[model samples]
Target: MRLSRYFLPVLKETPAEAQIVSHRYMLRAGMIKQASAGIYSWLPLGFKVLRKLENIVHEEQVRAGHIPMLMPTLQSADLWRESGRYDGYGEEMLRMQDRHGRDMLFSPTAEEMFTDVFRSHVKSYKDLPLTLYQIQWKFRDEIRPRFGVMRGREFLMKDGYNFDQSKEDALHAYNRHLVSYLRTYERMGLQAIPMRADSGPIGGDYTHEFLVLAETGESEVFYDSEITDLKFGDREIDFDSVEQCQAVLEEFTSRYARTDETHDEAVFNALPEERRRVARGIEVGQIFYFGTQYSEALGATVQTPDGTSVPVHMGSHGIGVSRLLGAIIEASHDDKGIIWPEGVTPFHCGIVNLKQGDEAADGACEALYGSLTALGLEPLYDDRNERAGGKFATMDLIGLPWRITVGPRGLKNGVVELTCRRTGESEELPPEQAVAKVAEIYAGI
Candidate 1:
């Protein structure tokens, strides 16, 4: 993509309403624009990153044996009524009536709708261990929606529901989700700690919220500092093996961690003083093992081997797909701008033509751009006829992982400047070597 042809309307000044770093940067970078008080229109760059995050979630979910499907943004109020939550869900759910006077809603969550789907077609224990998910837009009318996408009125989310024959199977599904979520966040260059959290409206005794610790986070959290040291790394796990999944769940959750809603001072005090820590956290995902809460209410029962019927054990897992953009920026950005991780960056690297019209410089940048693109990588070339300072500033503001600076001076010496956006470090290398290095850096990711 060439900067001259792109539609990035970056701002020279931050919007006064953007209170946090992510929100401010997002506005200044022209990643999103406010459509309403708490709603936004994702610009091209923001949409690209959002899609990248969505794809990662899909890949991890599929790797864990979950099926993907689509669900509507609007749903009938009848399903919520059957689950006895039509009135109980409160104002956050956007309830209304259609032309025929049937009560409908812009779904804040899909527990009731998914249960309705389960009961409609699934009727036997043989097909009990099914997990289905969708990446869709959800609306929750926040009373005071702020913080850009972090607490928006409408957001994108990946919510999955698991149906099982027994409590044990349902719990295993919960663990599988935990493992997959860990991978998903890590791939996006975030360490989202799985903390014991209160399942407010979802109604579950067993739940964990994955949070990325940031000073601007909404949730106050207490934890043992050791929990921050855990990482899933590249270890292999059989998602179908209960023991394997259970082991990972224990490994990651054994430490003391809880959100403010579920915090116990006594339990926290038991930890070593050195390990005790308190901080703020941005919630990026959650998993709930609600058992028969939805199934029983909706009559989503399956016939057992002996011909008896029982409500299927069930759970719902979710990742805040759009909010993750804010969380990643909050956790990864520096004073200058967002430092996108290679795995989720809109472009793999950037090409800066320091002397845009200079023949040698222009030729070098064009060659580098072609080389990177041919290697299955995306490069954003700043080919605009602008000053070197302005071009460099734009590259830094957009925060591509790597940048290749081509200039007549560097080309005369048979080298180009390859710089790391995160480290502020640069290396002088031949044009081909710069491209090769960028490719090598993202190969593993």
Candidate 2:
């Protein structure tokens, strides 16, 4: 991608309305545009990163054996009515009457819809442990939607529903999702702690919110420091062995962690001072074991081995896909712009043609761009006639993990400079060696 051909409408000054660093930087970098008060149109660059995040979520969900199929954004009110939540869901629910004067809604969540689907197809215990998910847009009608995409009324989310025949089996499904969530955040370069959470509108007794700690976060959370350092790589996933999956979850859950709603003063007091951490955190993902909540209401029953029909025990897991873009920026970024994690970065490397019109600079940049593309690295070539400082600023603002400067001096001398955006370390290497070095560095990141 060339900067001259890109649709990045970067601003010279911060927008006055952006309250947080992530929100402000997102606007200044031209990543998104506000389509309305609580909605946004994701610009090209923003959409690229959003797709990467969604794919990572998809991969992790698939690894946990959850199949994907999309559901509609609008749903019939009769589905909600079966759950007795048509009236109970309150104003956040975007309820309306259709042309036929029948009630409908822009779905805030998909429990009732999934329930209806489950009951329609699977009739026996053999289809008991099924997990289905989708990555789609949802509308909530937030009264005071602010903070850019972080709390937008319309956003992208990955929500999964699990159906099982018994509470114990449903819990096994929940623990698989728990492990999957840990791996999902880990892949995105985030340390998300699973804390007990209030069920809220998604009614359930057992709920866990995967939160990433950031200074600008909305929720107050306390956790043992070790929880942040816990590595998912330490254990292997045995999805078929329910007990083993439960053990892995118990190992991580044993470390003290709780959101404000479930925080225990005694537990906090007992922790050694150095081991404790209290901070604000963003809720990036949430999982709940709502035993028969939607299934019972919607009559999603499966026949048991003894030929008795019972409502399938159920759970739902959600990842705030668009909100994570903001959360990633909040956790990262310095005085410059976003410092994107390599896994979710829109481009792998950015090639700055510091002297765009100069033949040597242009030639070297085009060659390097071709080389990067051949190596499966997406490199943005700043072939626009711009000052070195402006090109550098744009590259930093877009926040590719690696940067290569093809300046007049370097091109003339047969050496190009490769810089690590995160570390600000630069090394001058012959043009022939730059591609291999970048491939090696990015492979490590």
Candidate 3:
């Protein structure tokens, strides 16, 4: 996209309301706009990143054998009542009534609604292993919604529900989700530790919250420092094999890790002092194995092979799709601005014409942009008639993973400056070489 035609309303001064790095940078970088006290309108750049995250989630989920479908933002209160949570869900739920005075709600979660769908059509054990998910908007009316998208009242989330015939099957589904989530977060350049965590209103005895450690995180966390050394690198796996999935679950969760809500001082003290670490964590996702909690409550039963009706075993998995933006920024940004990972950057590379109107400089940038675009990559060309410093500052602020600097001086030497945002390193390469390097960097991703 050309900077001159883009609708990025960057701020010269940070908003006073932004209290953290992610919030301040998001505001000053023109990623989001506050539509209300606890709500926001995602600007083009922000929306692009959000969609990228959603796509990664969808791809990983499908690879793990889960199907995707969408659900509504608003649902009937009757479903919540059927699940026995209508009154128990408390003020975070936005309860309302329609024109006919039928009670309704802006759903904070879709447990009850998903269960309703299950009971209505899925009546046999043959469909027991089905897992369905949706990426949609959700609302939870927090009394003090701060930290931009991190703790906003309205957010985007990917929530999946699994239905199974037995406890063992349900547990396997849980493990599958854990494996998929590990891949999902790693693809976004995050290391989300799966820590034993309390299941808050969801009512599950078994649950794990994936957290990215950041000083600005809200949840106080304790962990074995060795856990931080763990990485889910690129590995082949059969998602359908219970043993494989279970092995991964054990590998990632064997370390001592827990949030403040479930911290046990005695257990933590047993770990070697050198291996113990305490810090703050931003929750990016969670998985729950609740057995029959929602199914029994909502009468989502299936017929067994022996002709008996039984409540299906179930679990729910979720990724905070929008909040992930804040978590990624908190974990990856430097003092200057966000350093977006290549996998989720809005633009793959940026083209800066150090001398915008100069014929040679402009021609070089246009050529580089075309070369990158032809390779199925998007490059932001700062074609605006602006000073070199201003253009470079904007490129840094928006945080593209790669940048190509074009100038008459560089062109005369048959070279262009290619810079990496994460490392303040640059290399002088020919225009084609710069484009080829960027393409190869993202090829595996």
Candidate 4:
């Protein structure tokens, strides 16, 4: 992508309305624009990152054996009424009426809709232990939505529903999702600690919110530092073997961790002083094991082998896909701008033509850009006739992992300077060697 041809509308001065670092930087970087109080139109650069996140989440969920399905953004209110939550869900529900005067709503969550789908077709234990998911937009009327996409009223969410024939089966499915969530966040270069949390209106005795610690986070969280060092890759997971996944889940959950909603002060105080960590947390994902909550209320029952009918035990898992874009910046940005993780960055390399009109400089940058793209890399070439400082600042603000500079002097010497945005390190290399070096740095192998 060429800068002159790109739609990146970067701002020079920070917006006054942005209270937090991510919120301010997002505006200044022009990644998103406010469509309303809490709604936003994701610009080109922002949409690229959001789509990458959704793909990662989708891959991880599929690896955990959950099938993908698309659910509607607008759903019939009858489903919620059937589940006995129409009145109980409160103001966040976004209630409305259609032209026919029938009740409708932009679903804040899809627990009821999934239950209805299950009751309509799945009639036996044969279809038990099914897990389905969707990546879609959701609406919630936040009284005070702030901090950019971090707390937006309209946002994208990756939500999954699990149905099992018994409580034991449902627990196993829930634990599988917990393992998947940890893997997903880690792949995106985020440390997410699973902490016990309140079910809220979702209504479940068993719930866990995966939190990424940041100063601007919305929830207060307490945990053991050891949780940060733990790695899921260290363990061998046999997905077919439920016990293997169960053991991994237990190892992580055994540590002390909880959000303010479910904090047990006595238990927290008993921890060794050095291991204790109290910080603000941004919720990236949440999972719940609600046994028969939706099934019983909505008559979602299946046949048993003993010729009896039984309510299906169910659970729901959610990842705030759009919110993660802001949450990651909140945790990783520096004074210059966002320090995007390589996995989620819109492009891996920013190729700057420091002297665009100069034939030699332009030739070197164009050659390097072509080579990088051919090697399966996404490179942003600044072909605009701009000053070197402005080019550098624009690249830094967007936070591509690497910057390759082709200036008149460097081009004369048959060399280009490769800059590491995260480390602020640079070294000169021949144009032929630039692609391989950038690939190595991106892989970090």
Candidate 2 on 13-36: residue-level lDDT in tens? 998989998899899988899999
TM-score of each: 0.99, 0.98, 0.99, 0.98
List of clashing residue pairs for candidate 2: none
For candidate 3, lDDT tens digit of each residue in 332-363?
98887889999999999999998877899988
Model 1 C-alpha lDDT versus the unseen true structure:
0.94
Off by over 4 Å in 4: 234-236, 442-445
Question: For residues 1-445, what per-residue lDDT tens digits would candidate 1 score against the true structure?
Answer: 9989999999988889999999999998989999998899999999999999999999999999999988899999988998899999999999889999999999899988888888999999998699999999999999999999999999999999999999999999999999999999999999999999999899886899999999999999999999899889999889999999999999999999999999999999999899999999999999999999999999999999999999999999999999999999999888888899999999999999888788898888889988999999999999999999998888888889899998999899999999999999999999998889999998899
Write down the worst ten-residue block by lDDT for model 3. Answer: 3-12
TM-score result, candidate 4? 0.98
Candidate 3 Cα lDDT to native: 0.94
TM-score attained by model 2 = 0.98
* Model 4 per-residue lDDT at 39: 98
> Whole-model Cα lDDT per candidate?
0.94, 0.90, 0.94, 0.90
Worst 10 residues of 1 by lDDT: 354-363
Q: What TM-score does model 1 achieve against the real structure? A: 0.99
User: Residue-wise lDDT of candidate 4 within 191-251, one digit each (tens)?
Assistant: 8899999998898989999999999889999998888888876344666577977888899
